[model samples]
Structures are given as C-alpha cells and as structure tokens.
Target: MSGQNAKPEATPGVRQFTVAPDDDGIRLDRWFKRHLPQVGFGMVSRWARTGQVRVDGKRVKPEDRLAAGQVLRVPPGGESDRPKPQRRQLSQDEIDRAEAMLIARTDAALVLNKPPGLSTQGGTKTTQHVDGLLDAYAGDDEPRPRLVHRLDKDTSGVLLVARTPGSAAFFSKRFSGRSAKKIYWALVVGVPDLAEGEIDAPLAKQPGTGGEKMHVDEENGQPARTLYRVLDRAGNRAAWVELQPMTGRTHQLRVHLAAIGHPIVGDGKYGGQDAFLTGTISRKMHLHARRLIIDAPKDSRGGGGKLDVTAELPDHFAASLEQLGFDAGMSDARPVAEPPRERTPQEKKQAARQHARQYRKARRGERRTRGAPKPDKPGKR
Candidate 1:
C-alpha cells in the first residue's frame, strides 16, 4: 500500500516502495491500481509525464513494466475511496454446476476439472461460461477469482484460477515466462511415424474461420512448438498421444497434429472427415488437458511451494481409452528427464588428462609389484 495514493494527506511526502515478488513484470499503471487502488489512471498518466512517479530513480511511463525489487517513488494524495461494483448474483443451478467441478482449492488458487462443454471465457453467443461462474468461488469480501489461462471449449481438464489479484499477477508472470508446464492427452486418428518428437511448425489463423481455426503457415506465422510422445497404440488405427506445447498459440496442438497427418480424433475442423472413427468410438474431441505443474504461492506448505495438479480423463475420453484397450492410469504423460549437460572443451580435456594419469599410476604400481615384491622367489627369501 506504500505506492498507493490512498489518502495523500494521510502521509504527505514522497514515499519509496520496493516492488514485491507478486508484482514482477506488471505495468506501472496496474501496479498502482493493485497496491494503490485509489490512484486513478489520469493521475498515474500525469505523474508519469511530470516525473512524479519513478521506478528505480528513473522516470517511467505508465505502461512501463515493473520488476521485483525495483524501488517505486510515490507522490501521495490522489486516493479515491471508490466502492467496488456490486457482486453479480449467480443462479443456484450455475453455482451447483461450478461447485461440482472443483477439483482443488488453496488460499491463492483454484484448480477446476472444467467439463468438456464448458467454455473458459464467454464469447458472442456463449451465454454461460466459466468466467460467469467464477463468482461461486468468491468469499464474503474476497475479490472474484481470476482465470490465469484458457482451455478450448470441449477441451476438458485442469484449469487454473487465481484467488486474488496478487496471486493472479504472480501466476500470469509464471505462464508468460514459460515456467509453467502443461501436458495434454489426446487420441489421434492414426499413429505418428515416430514414437516421440517435437513439432516446430509456425501457425497462423486461417483466412475465415471466425478466428476459430488455425493453419501451419511457414511464410507468415507465429512460432509454435509442441513436443509429443505416443503413449499407447491400437495397432496403426489410433494412438494415445501426450502433447506438451511450448508456445501457447490458438489450437496449436490440433493444427500441428493435423499438419503431421495424425489429426486428433473428433477434430473435424482441422482433420475433415478422417478425424472421426466409425463404430463404438464417440465422435467427440479426444483432447484433454491432463496435467499442470507450476510454482505455488510462496505461502503454500511443502517443498518450497510447488504446485502439481492433474485432471482425470473426461467421461468420453476415459471411455475411448477403455474402448481402445488403453489403461487410463498407465501413462502419466510426464516429460522425459533432461540429459546431463555436456562438458565444455576445457573440462573434457582436463578429464581426459586425469584419466590418463590414473592409468599411468596403476601401471607403475603393477610394475613396482612385479619388480620388487615377487615374494623372494617363493621359498628363497
């Protein structure tokens, strides 16, 4: 609250505030709004222009990002005792449905096993979405939970929600920094040629798909990479695959798989008629957000606050796995452990020299034993 212009007269003077870890990589204006909720955007803009607000003794714009440990100079007295908007009332049915989806909850986070049909955020025609249902998780005076990431509609699995704005900022930074790990399980129409590999294709939105479809556009596309491993196979007809997308692009996994000729089952948008399999297999999308691993809030218990959460397979996806004779729990879809780092040239040379010296020492010891300690020709000694 030090940087906040709350009650400028309460403490009339310039104040220096150190940015907290939660505020790393946040915009200057947002930092003021969070810590100094009373500070208006107009005031922040004026201060930035006149050099009243500075970050680390340097004048910064309202859009400048702030890093942890940076000192923020605050000029007080723009505090506005603005009341928050009234909490939106949610229907009992909506509340019940959302509560039933709760998989895990903590002081700073909420992990939900979002159902396949539920949209993460609302859209033009989307009357009901997870964003509208988040009010169900709010406490009496707590701020509404904020979504940290998005899962595609029909992609069932673990969706993270931040309990407060501070935690939201922290989790957002982790995601943008690529420190968070996400693993998705999907059933594809056919097995890939390789058991495991990386897809480093770039993707761009298609010309006209309502911004819902993507295509691999080598000429002009954003860089996207996905690491995939075939977990199990039902002959060459279908395969269970684990996907880890390094970059968060719209429909990256689906587009990449389709581009590789192994489009995900039930993904007709990209795969066409070949996406679905006839018979007992359902025609629903088989992709499910299976697991997420990221750092927990600093206050969490156990092992420096590591947060690892996994979502169970959705009903249709689970049934597909069973139908294909694949064990739902057999593959955890964890990434392969990184190999040991290669030694530098200098270090390699030093090791070789050390080995050679050890070998020479062993040979000398053997020679000494043969020359001097022959036990005096057995009985002659």
Candidate 2:
C-alpha cells in the first residue's frame, strides 16, 4: 500500500526552438499553430490548458499575446509538436493486410479502427506508436494521412483519420458541431440507481497537476454532458455501462463516472484505485470505444446515408469479458492485439494475504468439530 500514489520522474527532454517575431503578437496558441504548422491547434490548446506550454517559466493562457524572446520549453512525448526525418520501413505485403479494415475510403478520407495503446501519432522522442507504423497503414499514399481525433492510450475502438487536407477539414467541422455520435462500453465500480440517466457535470482540468485529471467543476469549468445507462450488473461490486458523449473534452467520461461516485476500476488516474492488480484481469476499467457514427462527406458526384465505423474489443477486453461470464466468441466489431499482462510483486503480496485468510478459516473449522465433544460432556454431567 505504501508509495502506491507515487508518480515516476518526468520523461527527459532538451530545449527546442521556433522564434516568434515582434509582429506575431497573436494568441499564444494561434501563434504556435502557425509557427509549428505540423502540430494541431488542439494540441497547442491542450498544452496551454494544462500549463505544459509555458511562457517565461509561467503558464500562459491560450489567447495570451506572445512577446518576442519569451523562453518556452517543448516537453517530450507530444505526437503533434514533434519533428522527424522521413523514412520507409514496412514491406508492401504488410501494408495491404493492415488496410483491409477500411470501411470507407476516398482520396481525402479513410475511416479505420485504431487499436488500444496505439498513440494517434508519434512523439518527439518515441520508439513505437500507431503513427510510427503509418507506412504500413497508409500504404504508398504520399504526404500520408492525419488523425482527426484520439482515443485514450488504453482505449480500443474506432478512430477517424483523414487522408487528405480537404478531407481533414471536412471531418474537423463535423466533430466541432457535435454531429458525430461516439458510443462506448465501460465496466464501472457499481450500478447507478437509475437504469438510464444523463450526467451533466461541468468538467475542469484536475487542479494542482496539469492534464492529469478532470474534476467536477461546479464553477470555473466548461460545459460537458454524458448520457449513460446500465447495460448489465456484474455480481454486486461492478456493472457494465454504456456512454454517449455529448462533448469531447479530455477524460470527460472518466471524470463524469468518478464524480457520480462510480469510478471506472483500473483507471488509476481518474478511477484512482489499484484493485485490478489481483486477478489475471490487470487494467480492468473495461472501457471500450465500441462504435462511432459520423456523417461522411456527401460524394463529389452524389450523396447518401451517414458513414458508420465500429472497432471491437481488443483481445484483452474480450478475454476479460469471458472470464466474467460474457459469452465466448460473442458479437464484436473488430479483433485487435491485446496488451501484454505482467504480474507485479505488489500483486503477488496481495494474493498471499488472501491465501493466509483462507488458511485461518480452515483451521477454525477443524477445531470446532461440530457436536463431537459437546455430546460427551453433556452425558458425563
């Protein structure tokens, strides 16, 4: 139990630079967006929101005007704000197989399933991520594609990527207007009293730490809405739930679930419990991206119904459900590689404690011997 809350040291990085001219007094976020053309504006907004992108060793607001020569530290592990040389790695055969999941493809867009634990893009100093293998996924397409939205590092589900700049603009507009429906499945700590209800808690970035959490901010927060329903009850301690996010704020579902007193188990950051370490079911939040419904661009030649894409539970989630009584080989969207499971020494210690408790109970039962001695004593008396 000791030191369970300790966070490791920050990832190491060195200073990098892109100078802002005197005339570039534009919003700090906007300025970064322009100067760092490769990085997404939202990534910059996130850094500003979280205080990672600071000015003069202090945090700067998104719209804060920039003064020339203010020192900035670009942290390690950003997918968007990093630069690297181009190279080819995967063979042609590998590229074909990975692209087989394409539900819809055009010169401008291609919607695909993004497996859990795959970062949307590569980092400044990263070894492997979803974006790291773009050569295999994107095939021979020049200039490649870009991710429009990101699932959490451990969330397995549908991800939308735009193949062209024009398509990227189209998809971005749809997302901004909330025209897309994002549905998810999460196994939570306990069942809610209501079968179906909406949680309309405003969420603000968790205080004290930057970008680490989202808390229920009654005041000084942005509007966020999440619609949820109990899918099925799991014994007494947990329940399977469905989530429909009305707003796409970071950690919105995780925060809303926590605010209502039912944090997603194994979600140590927001769910904040280390209980899942005991069973083979490590990382038990059980949240799956499940499905996404978005309005595909009306064809340049004509038009039709909205585009739908679904990514099934990766192997780990599937295995967990089977262990918990979900039917084996049940219907799912897609099959993905599972996260590697490891048994930590701490988990072994917890298991040992359980065995000791069972041993003591057995010893007590042996001593009682039901009515064996009691009857003889009564007769003697």
Candidate 3:
C-alpha cells in the first residue's frame, strides 16, 4: 500500500522494506526468503559478515528475529545479479498467444485463463511459458508483471499477476498468512463417503523422484490439509468436487484425493491408469482453479472488504461438466457467515501458558546468542 513501486535509486546502492506485521517473529534469514528470495542464503551470510545487511541501521545475525515496521536494508546488486537461468526471449507468436489469454486487467492485477498445456514459468527444456510472454501484457511505463502464485502446467483456470512491486508484496503477504481463499473444481473417479470433510495429512517428496512427486509421510512430512465438498455426482462412476486446500503443498489436492480412493479424473501420475475413464471424457487433467478472493491493498480504493474473481472453466472441463449433468452456474454452498467457535476457559488458559513458555524460551535463547563468541574461520581458529 506504500505505492513505492519505483525502482530503487542507484545512488543508495541498497533497497529497503518495512517488515510486515505477520513477519514480526520470523528470523532475519527467513525474512530474506520471503521478500528477496533471489538473494541466496550464502549471499545473506556473506552480507552479514561484511556488515551490509542491517535491521534499523544495526548489524544483526542471520538468525536474529525481525520486528514489525523495522526497516531492513539490503545491498542492491544481489537481487538483480543472483545466479539464475537466463530468461529466453519470447517469439512474436508466443507473445500474441499470451495476450490472447488475458481475461481481465486492472491497475494492480491481471487475470488470465491459462490453457492446459502451457507452463506457468520457464525452466530447463521449457522454451515456451507464460512468464516469457508477460511482457506483451505490460505497458511502456509498467513494471514487468510478477507472478503472485502458480498453477500446475496442466491445470487451467484463473491465474493472478501483480502489476506493481507494491501489489506483489501485498499479495505475497496475503498468501503466506493464509488469508487468500482459492477454490478448485475437479472431477474425481469416485464419491467421498461423507458430504464434506477436511483432510489433514502430512506430505513429503518421494525420494529419488527428482522432487516432482509428493507422498503422505506422517512421520516426517510437512502438514497439509484440504477441505472437500461433493457438488454433483454421476452414480458411482464420477463426481464433481469442490476442493479448498487449507495448506498449500506440492500436489496436495491430487495426493489427498487419491489417498481417499477418488483420485482426480485423469491424474494418472498420482492415481495410476485407474484415474481415467473409458468414455468420451478427455484425457487431460480434470482440475481447474475456479475462484480466488483476497483483500485488496489498503492504499487502494478505501481498502474494500475483498476482491472476488471467478474464472470460466476450460473447454475440456466445461464439456465434461455438461456431460456429467453438473450446473456450472451453481452458487457456492460454503457459508460466508460461519462464525468462529468460542474457545473454552480451559483452552484459553492452556493457550496463554503455551505463549508464555515460548516467549520465555525465545528470550533466553536470544540472550545466550547475544553474548556468545563468534566462530572464527576454520584455519584461523
């Protein structure tokens, strides 16, 4: 909301940001990952060693905690010069194709109906991607629109792009804080036994799978959750389900659905060939990002309640819906007025005790570290 979208001046040789409220207790190293991810951990350590990275003009260790509203100074060059694959130029055809996908545009954001086959961002062996063509949607004075979130290459629906650096920061905070609401529609092979439920499972990457696949690993996985409601059913064969991932993880929706014995239609990777049907249904993935709602930046338009946007289903998804007798125009079943349950007195007392313990522990650790001797280089020591 600061409207400080202009590029940092060269004279200062640094860029700075005020820590957001949600980041108050996060470590300095994690803060860099949140805001300036391009600056690698190694570079941050080097900067801290050289006294280039500072919080409120005071030198701090990488593990130091950050307070909300404190100013953080970062040297400019690492952000632009960090090692990354050179972005390939987009051909005129690619640019045209990208512009053609634009469904809505605003001063702060752009929404695109991403096609099923297009990758969101480029990578090795990926010559054509949405990131490469974003320039086509930018005006002469606009900064290159930044991808606020990503969808799987085969998943099609509304994709949001931030038009300015301030907007980018604002949306990023919303996402990390779990304040953004995202709805996804998918055709699953079978119906869930219950009308609606939440799946709370932990997920981890499969070893030796090149980090492309995820599996449920209760022992070591990170917590992931999804809320599902069956919207329409076609006998025992297939069902259209609405999924809201409470925690974002790689392939969470796909993995959770499969774990429940109803893998998403055509998600062969997770559900195997059983995920497919013999009829006229397309082999393409049946998942679509249906709707997204988030708070607009405070500095914009009186800081209105929230911005709601819905995306039309892709051609394959729409056709499949029609074939399944599902009404695409149906209203949302989730209630907006669902109030939070009141906590019991015992629960509140336990929560207060837990908070006090953590605060005391963190303070003790900080005191020890503040007076601890700095480690010397291996040879020098």
- How do the residues 127-180 of candidate 3 rate in per-residue lDDT, one tens digit apiece? 777888888876654467889899999998888898766567778888888788
* TM-score-sorted candidate list, best first: 1, 3, 2
lDDT of 2 by residue, 1-381 (tens): 110111233446634443333212456665555444565777777877897777666887878876544565555555654664466676565465357545566545676666666556666665555555555545543446677888777676777887644456667878999888888887777677777766666667877887677776655667677778776666766666778888888888887776665767678776555225346765745677777777775443345257776776767777766666655233333332122243365653454344334434544554676535645666575
Compared with the true structure, what per-residue lDDT tens digits does model 1 show for residues 1-381?
A: 422222222346877788765566789999877767778999999999999888877999999999877888888677767875677798899899999989998877899999988899988899889999999998775677899999999899999999878788778989998788888999998888889866766678888886778876655778677888889999999999988888899998998887777779999988778799888999999999988888876532222377889998888999999999998887774453332355565754554344335435644765686699445676674
Question: Candidate 1: which stretches are off by over 4 Å?
Answer: 1-32, 35-38, 41-83, 300-304, 333-381
Candidate lDDT (C-alpha), each: 0.81, 0.62, 0.77
- Candidate 3, lDDT over the whole model: 0.77
Point out the higher-scoring one by lDDT: 1 or 2: 1
C-alpha RMSD of each candidate structure in angstroms: 19.1, 17.5, 17.8
Clashing pairs in 2: 312-334
RMSD (CA, Å), candidate 3 to true, equals: 17.8
